[model samples]
Target chain A: MPHRPALTPLVESLPATVPFVGPEAQERSRGRPFRARIGANENGFGPSPRVAAAIAEAAPESWKYCDPENHDLRAALAAQLGVGMENIVVDGGIDILLGVTVRQYVEPGAAVVTSLGAYPTFNYHVAGFGGRLVTVPYDGGDRESLDGLVDAVKREGAPLVYLSNPDNPMGTWWEADDVVRFIDALPETTMLVLDEAYGETAPASALPPLDVTRPNVLRMRTFSKAYALAGLRCGYAIGERETIRAFEKVRNHFGMSRLAQVAALAALHDQAHLADIVTRVAACRDRIAGIAAENGLVALPSATNFVAIDCGGDGDFALKAMEALVADGIFVRKPMAPGLDRCIRVSVGPEAEIALFAEALPPALAAARGG
Target chain B: MPHRPALTPLVESLPATVPFVGPEAQERSRGRPFRARIGANENGFGPSPRVAAAIAEAAPESWKYCDPENHDLRAALAAQLGVGMENIVVDGGIDILLGVTVRQYVEPGAAVVTSLGAYPTFNYHVAGFGGRLVTVPYDGGDRESLDGLVDAVKREGAPLVYLSNPDNPMGTWWEADDVVRFIDALPETTMLVLDEAYGETAPASALPPLDVTRPNVLRMRTFSKAYALAGLRCGYAIGERETIRAFEKVRNHFGMSRLAQVAALAALHDQAHLADIVTRVAACRDRIAGIAAENGLVALPSATNFVAIDCGGDGDFALKAMEALVADGIFVRKPMAPGLDRCIRVSVGPEAEIALFAEALPPALAAARGG
Candidate 1:
């Protein structure tokens, strides 16, 4: 075999793996579509009607590049968050922002800390940048192991740490006070990437106020979850002006698609829709918990778009049940790490989709038991 | 003045700067919109009518994540290019791809080669990745010196080199045979990023046929220009299967927005619209040339969506002329590097906008020349 142009030593050593296989790829392999389409924790209730109108209105003007500065969107987001425009930075999504933040602080082999089975996408980015990851296993309750994370940071002398409030997979959170403690305990030289993706779905007490005076923490939020603009891929980070300005050095200036800005701006204006979606999300979480109870399973209380149903079995059994659901055309996901794998994740969807999940669960559990 | 999170030594050493500012940002500064929006090479002609319909149709469904694999779009692009799906990787745009590509092959302080005054975004990405840039000056006739670039790569022992076919800033290209020679002469370990962003506008003879067998070269293209979906931020890279697959290790998987995918797919299906656009672009180039000649200035031959008009003066005169045009409510940009600074770049817009340029130029030139 001929040796092609070699990737840099770092790239050549890295594996070609992604954090998650999108549900669309799953549907393609199934050669048919999923009935519920609820696995990825996307808002099944969808974005506001007004956001749709804004996107449609801008569709004809898609020939233009988005504003490189994201001026109006940043202005609006900053005003909404009560921060200056210089305090906010926008990108394709929180995923991209995570990558940028990692790039900015962590060098190859630099230690970075996160909870095991937290947000895999953040880990994927740290790995992508060749950062050494120091993971602490979950504390076995709904909350991420805050104490464990801080210990790892101090032990590793890590420059960066990631925390997901109202976190994914387990759907847990640390209250603002505990979160503040975590922030205060960190070394001033260590940056805290607080992933607040589910901030709107989370109770207000779980969220810290948006203050960009601190140089050590970058708070992130997105239009993907409660805002129902997941398909549009808009996210922003709030930090001190100096830290936020560094993103301009490397960000794809024209990366934000014009329609994405339009959709996010419109969604921000329609607070009623967001409030209504938050109410719907809470109700759906309750409905999912009820369904889990009907199947003799325990549903972890959630503050995000998905609930974790503890299958009262091993990871293998949970995996089998999830496979069964997929086979039955009900898409769902599970945390892949050992201890967390005992549970399967189901996103909060509209009633009809949840009804389909309700109908599929008992049979899925039976199949997993080799009935 | 407090000790903040320390950026990586390399990142800290880099200057904070944005490569290009959008017209919208200029408008914000000027406190009024420009009468003619022509600075960036965006297709003001707009996307196909079909693409607009597709975005509109997908607007309400913006709740789902885009396929991380980008399967359908790759399948279509592969079939169109006569290559396997394994040979293609898609990203938000060529801008994002540049960053990924730089990260893939460049570790801190690795040497990279490109022509001076080419695409500054590519340079920004290279610098951000801590690559030592070795830039070859434009050769005689304002052409990117292929010979100079090859020499620089070998001399610097560079791991990566970038070339934009029908190069930006100045729309110049070497024919297919010369490009083939350039490819053949490159070392087995030196990757070539051949950007064909303006491929749709360049003559067929200018583009070499797609061949993914060479590991040293990744050809990049985008929907931003010809497909008229700049706002949607979709672009793709074609190379050897292994080289293309390497991108997965670092790319943000869910970064591609759902509406962006649907829009690009629809645009691809409308070949007639593309052909019409090519014709319209050719006419606009000619019109811009005529406008330049009417003012006794010379317009360079172009193979892209924008025209470069020589102001027949020094760098300062061209800068002043360009600024004067902006003051006159006409949005046009100019090259900034020393040798290339004598020409102003104007994007091709509608005839009405071109007429606005014609009306404003004489006075702008007079003001620039000391009226």
Candidate 2:
């Protein structure tokens, strides 16, 4: 065999598996498009029209590289969050930021903590950096166990911990006071990466006020959710100035797209559109719950743009239902972790797509039951 | 001071410095925009109109995340490059791919080699990953020294080496046969990151045929140059199948902006526009050379989108001229390295911007001469 350069042992040991297989890949393999594209928890209602207009306007100026400082978008976020611009570091998305954060904090064989079935992308980053992941199972209520995470951090002396409020896979959440209590309980040296990607869709009470005084907490927010600019790939982390400054040491500063900045700024400016989206998302949740009830399933209370419906059976049953729905061209997803796997997750979209999901559910349920 | 989480020792050791300060940062500091935006080697002729149309058409679909696999874009690239789809890995840009490559190949303190004044972003990544960089000086002709780089790689036993053909900041190139010889001379254990971001603007004879059989060589190309989609943040790497597969082990799969894929695919389909841009860039390079001659400066032969004009003095003199040009609203930059710093680099742009540069050059040169 010809000699070849060897990958660092850490990277070589990593499994070449993606965290999520996107619906587009499914479409390619299936040889047909999903009639309802709602599997990825994307804001299928789409970005504000103003954002589209801004993107169209900026398209002609696509030659310019993005501002490395991300000054304008960070300034806008600072104003909106009532924090200093230095407290924010905007990047491609929460996904890319997670990798950066991991690189900053994780050394080889270092421990990192997260919920068992939390965002797989975060787990991917931890593994990519060779961090030993110590997972805490979700509580009986399907919420991330704050006490468990604190205990794991103390036990492993983990440098980083991840928590996604208004959680993924299972849409349960903790109110601000409880979250604050959890924060107070963590070891001071343990950094908490509080992902609030779904923040805009959740109730205000579920979010704690910005606390830039704490050096260990980094709260990440994105335009991808209720802002409906997922494709724009813009996200920001709010933290103490020095904590945010650490990003500058390792970030690909010019990695952001110029149009991402323009689209995010326009989306942020349209508060009226955001409010409308939130309202529509709440209504869609109820509609999905109603559809679940019609199918003899239970829908979990959700503070996010997506609803997780318990299929009144087991993980295998939910998987069967999800596959049936996918086969019928109604794109939907299910949680795969043991306890959470009984549920199928569906994101809220425009009425037309949701109506398609509603129409496809009964047959999908029948197929799952082999009736 | 309150207790806080600490950055890893490696990250703490790294300084918080950006690889290159963007022109936008300068504009913000100066409280005005430049008349000629040609400093960063961005293709100011802009992307194909077809790409803009594609972006506008796809703007409403901004809610969807990019296809994590980058299937369609990679397929197109593979078809164009005469390689299997598995031989390609697409990411945010060449900047990001550099970081990923460094992370994959360089262990902490591993030696990495590059031309002394070559791409700083690659150096930034090496430092960020705790790799010790070994620099090789350019030859007397001001081209990257292939023999010197080979010597440095052998001397340092460097795991990774970076080469940007039709190089940046100097805009000089070596012919294809020489590049192939350089590649052949390297030990197979040392990976060569061949950055061909300027490849599209160079003569076909300047680029070697794609040879995906070599696991030690990764050839990176981007839409940021000739295709003029820098704002889209789309670039790809071509390598042997297993080598390319290694990227999937660590990359942020969904980090690419959805519209970026649309824009790049559309840009690739418009070869006629790319050909037109290449022709225009050549003419503009000649125009810049003519302007430099009129100003009593020597314009270096360039095979890229930018030309470097020697100010016929030392580094300090070139710095003064570049500053004067910047003050006059002509955004030009100069090399800061020892031998290379005697020149100011200017990118090709529309006639209006070039005219602005032309008008500003005489006063800038006079200012440099203490007029």
Candidate 3:
């Protein structure tokens, strides 16, 4: 560390960490691939054939850079969402958009509010930007506390707040009416990042109507979940014209991948494919819940592509069960927060993966119980 | 603008602008595609067939998120560059890396240095981060002035300096020894961002050997140039372990596209394809120079995929010629700084594009002169 160029004081104080370790890293560490890849909430159902064809067609044209304005993809998203082009801004993924939004609104030591254990990537961005984060605990045992979030925002005078509908890990969601109530309660100056990454798989009741007149709320959607383009990295935010324009000021202008744009546009055109994947995801969620029942565990109600099964024990027991599953070549995840840590999180996938998880669940639970 | 969330002071002061418009945008505005797509320094030769095949193969697997660590690609780049895996970090592109670098080291009003008209994207990042930019004019009109950069860094006590060898816009380069001399001249506290985005197209003598032991130097290379994977958006930075580790603190951990990783890995494995492209680019460079000579203009020597033809006039004349070429369905660019603005840049492409330029130049020059 002798005479090296210095990092900013804020960056120097932060730890070098990735919010999530991808399944690829886990497999490499274990020296083998998992039999069931039902983790990280990816759509194992895969993208539509037309999307794949578009990607292949765009392959040779990869010599040219992507459109920095994200013109074509934005246009398609606007048309489909019944919003004007100025209401949308596209980026590599929701994660990048989160980072950009954090940078745009959160200054050093500025207060920001979110659920205590919701979306670690968002938290990472807040820390990266030196924002003071005020977290509200989950309401009851699973859902994000909407009332608590609003209270904290007002109390802390936070300028930014994040809420992910159809919550991850526990996979619970609030109804559209409750969401509208939360939005109506928020202060005019506080920006609400309503991340609906799982919007495609959730019931239509879980989402409010697309409204771009409100400048305080920015709704995030992704092609990663139901569209199966996680590896391609395409997501967009819909907000009022002026609020969406703020993203253009701080985002990496040339950051979007060109083939990603093509894949997303093609996916948008294939609504039949999306409808099929949504049906499949819902069925898989039911299947995963049934598997939990067979293992003598309770599965929470879920509107997302994953199910969280209570191990009927403490955090340590759930962690042990999840680790056992991983050791048995079945990839899974679990929440680490106190109340949310009583369950293992498993993503919805194809039958083969679901069958493998069903086969491994009992043994993993047995190992956790040492029975 | 009523009741909208307030942007950060820094972001509020910035403009919503794309650093460089993609050729796609130009085509959309012109209502037709360019006949000679020889602008933006893209590799018109396209990626290797193996790379295209790999992209097609990976298309269906886009359901999974990219490895947050970017492990495999970093390992491959490490082996190729003769550095440890810890010495390398991968991102979407050089533009993203530049943004991350600015975030890591620059605080508001902190000084950063670069050639006056080197890369607009870098300047964009610096501005986004609220850094005070100290620009050094290009030496004797073309090459980045290494000594002048040192003077500015010392005078302003700048923490970061950027120099792109085999540089963009001007198609100029500095010898390895001169580069090493510049490195030795800078204070250890001042980081040098040695952008080698065009390294693959340059002569071997123009690039210094990869050295990752220095804590202040970060060398950036991209697949966007010789490897013809610009649309895939992959770039890497090689540096000392400590310097490289700082990137993890501020980077979007899972931002790298999986298809981009696949395309770059395939490109690296196909050296013969890269060599072929290099040879083709060299020949096209010569052809472009011949076209310039025919038009009674001098072509600047280039160790890059593009040649800059000196129109032997002022900036306005060069701008008029470039616009005329664009109007004629021949996409070309030019440097916009004071001294460098006399040259219009033409990227190396297939013979058809070169021939198109050859046919378009005389008439465009005549129109420019008359206008």
Number of clashing pairs per prediction, in order? 0, 0, 0
- For candidate 3, lDDT tens digit of each residue in B216-307? 99999999999999889999999999999999898998888999999999999999999999999999899899989988899999999999
Give the per-residue lDDT of model 3 (tens digit) for A1-371: 44999999999999999899888899999999999888899999999999999999999999988888889889988888899999999999999999999999998999999998789999999999999999989998789999999999999989999999999778999999999999999999999999999998888999999889999899999999989999999999999999999887888877889999999999999999999998999999899999999888999999888999988999999999999999999999999888999989999999998999999989899999993
TM-scores (chain A) of the candidates: 0.98, 0.98, 0.98
Candidate 1, A72: how far from true, in Å? 1.3
Alpha-carbon error at A299 in model 3, in Å? 0.9
Location of the lowest summed lDDT over 10 successive residues in candidate 2 chain A? A135-144
TM-score, model 3 to reference = 0.99
Per-residue lDDT tens digits for candidate 1, residues B1-371, read 44799988878888878888788888888999999988888888989999999999999999988999999999999999999999999999999999899988887788899988889999998889888999998877477888998999999888899999897888778898899899888888899999999999999999998888988899999999988898899999999998999998888889998999999999899999999999999999999999999999999889999999999999999999999999989999988877889999999988889999999999999999994
**RMSD after CA superposition, every candidate:** 1.4, 1.1, 1.1
TM-score, per-candidate, Cα-based: 0.98, 0.99, 0.99
Residue B253 displacement (Å), model 3: 1.1
DockQ of candidate 2 (2 decimals): 0.85
In candidate 2, list every pair of residues with a backbone clash: none
Q: Which stretches of candidate 3 lie over 4 Å from their true place?
A: none
Q: Model 1 over residues A108-149: C-alpha lDDT tens digits?
A: 899999988888889888887889999898887456899999
